[model samples]
Target: MTARCSMRLEERSARHIDFTGREDRPVQIHLRDIKRTPGPPNPAGLDHDMSPPPRLQQVPTSPLLSAFSAHRSETLSAGRALFVEGDSGSDIHLLESGLIALSHIQPNGKRMIASFVVGNGVFSLSHDGMRLLTAEALQECRLRRVHRVELSHLPADQAEAVKAALDREPWDIQAETLMHLHKDADEGISYFLVRLAGRLNGPISRGSRVRLDMSRVDIADHLGLTVETVCRGLKRLRSDRVIDAAGPHNVIILEPDQLKRRAGLGPDFD
Candidate 1:
């Protein structure tokens, strides 16, 4: 590039010297108009001669996940793939609102969703995307994707948590924490619901039946259970008067203590 710069300067200098030698009468050469050769290419080192016209780059955005910068942020409609398996990881994503389904597509094109992350969900965040899964927004949503290279350094606690979450599938999260006297999708779903109820309200009481914040399909995906199984499990609970469905997104706890017992008793819990 420096060689190219020097040649350009030489060409311009030769032209300036021959100014009066033209066929026209003597013309005042505005000496000020002779621009000095630009100092060693500006820090960007871009070749001015061959560079393409610059487009309006999307805003210099920041990642909601943390301090990282994002190059793109937009509202994605349902069924949009944020990332695909085996693809190189260039960015980490954060779903500020709405839900996203994470799935693994089998060789036969069957999709087995591992989880459905809702508002404040994070994705594609491993150092190299070791746990590869395809993320698709299940509903209209807003997302932010930041270049991984730009976020090499992060604070201690957040960095550790995000890294661990990236290394393992979402199922591993509940599996590691919940003791399974009879570990299975059924029991996992029970535990998940009971916990969610407690989180949203309090310990199971007369009105303690948990109302799922997500849909039945979302719950099934998170627990590795089939949709039918999830529905049956909920129905079983309902028959036992543990809960009553107020509507699609609403449920009333009928027997909180019994529901907790059905989840299996623990001395620590008692």
Candidate 2:
């Protein structure tokens, strides 16, 4: 005979967890949630196209430049170095007019141009740190140099806008650098032309043209190609009837679609 013991189970009422402590935690802010003042409406009466092509969208107008315009402005002649690599990055530069080239020096002392900073572009955003790349004026330029402390003193909204722009700058440089690195000389040249056309806001018509102010040497440096290779590539594009040269600095896109294909941008072209 075995004596069995009976066990009884009792259910307890569920208790609500306290989330009051979580309410005291800091709320994270997102870049997209920061609203920016709308820019002036287009005078051309064209409806604003929010979704631009990748190449065109790569360099958007920086709110930092606008906010800092009155701080300090200086003009530099063509071929002048704005800042050399390894220099103290106490200040950031905003290109108001003309072009600036950002380059890196190799161990052998050869300079490799990495990217071009066009008007309304910001560069050297290291902010009181050592500069990562050398900046030079590709053409006569007017730039506004703002000290890191000044940027820090900006209003919260404007400061956030500047931060967003600064965050995007490196990714733009990498995308352009990789674009040139992976393509053949001809394709690279075509890509450069297409990019310039887009930047210049040239018409998208078949017969539309764009003026490339940079010389062949500049193009070579920017595209990571030899000057001779750039010349040959240009000649090939001309022969293919994809483009025609109005002068040494001007290029007409005779066949926009064909040029886009050669640039590896695909059939959608724009």
Candidate 3:
């Protein structure tokens, strides 16, 4: 299943979905910025964090992208939907830059965040042909969309590049499943923070402060916990000197090794 995103207080119905957002001009970035980074063959971290100040990597550039000339990039303002549930699945997106949240709304009106997408990640509608989740920008973002029709005609190597990108989606679902097995909310929260920290390394090292781009509510939804529970978990971590919530959105991982243990991550994952 493809992960998607949503964050709104409005009463939502499948019949009516909105894409309203704050005023922000479309940003244009060159295709050279659309690099490909390999995701772990197995789900390596907790909920995949896509926060800024990224952990830059060296991965092969998708030569397939050079073949396309007609597609144009578009800017997605913060809180805007790149595509809503039930929208046409005409294209799959390549996140050029910035963070995006993937979420799903249950029939009872509760929302569950699927995962987060950082730069170079790919997201699309559900595979069955209609959009199944809502993908919303957590911050101002720019992305390139390749039409599904265009994808079908690509040569083998180019097609493989796209497939490799899409392979990361299943790993997220698996990670989410693994998180729930522990049954401890604090452990789950630790797992979540550790994953975010892994992606957004600090200037000096991985132990530095990590800026959380998503809100407490988003974290709660992704972990299947309540906002209050999420708050308490952070508070507990703070009390133990495991982490420091420096501000509403900034967190400093005081003990990286201990944090991994709390998340049930072994030395191999570390």
TM-score of 3: 0.69
Residue-level lDDT tens digits of model 2 in 217-240: 567777877756777788888877
- Per-residue accuracy of model 1 over 61-114 as CA lDDT, tens digit each: 332355432224456655445554554564666676666666666666445555
Residue 59 local lDDT, model 2: 32
Report the lDDT tens digits of candidate 3 across residue range 2-78. 43333222222211111121223433211101112334322111122244433673333566454232345566666
Which runs in model 3 stand beyond 4 Å of their true positions? Answer: 1-71, 152-156, 202-206
Q: What is the C-alpha lDDT of each candidate?
A: 0.52, 0.64, 0.63
Where's the lowest-lDDT run of ten residues in candidate 1?
Answer: 6-15
- Candidate No. with top lDDT: 2
Positional deviation of 197 in candidate 1, in angstroms?
4.6
Error of 1 at 123 (Å): 2.4
Model 1 ranges off by over 4 Å: 1-73, 125-131, 153-186, 195-218, 221-225, 265-270
Clashes of each: 1, 0, 6
Rank the models by TM-score, top first.
Answer: 2, 3, 1
Name the candidate that leads on TM-score: 2
Error of 1 at 8 (Å): 50
Model 2 poorest 10 in a row by lDDT: 27-36
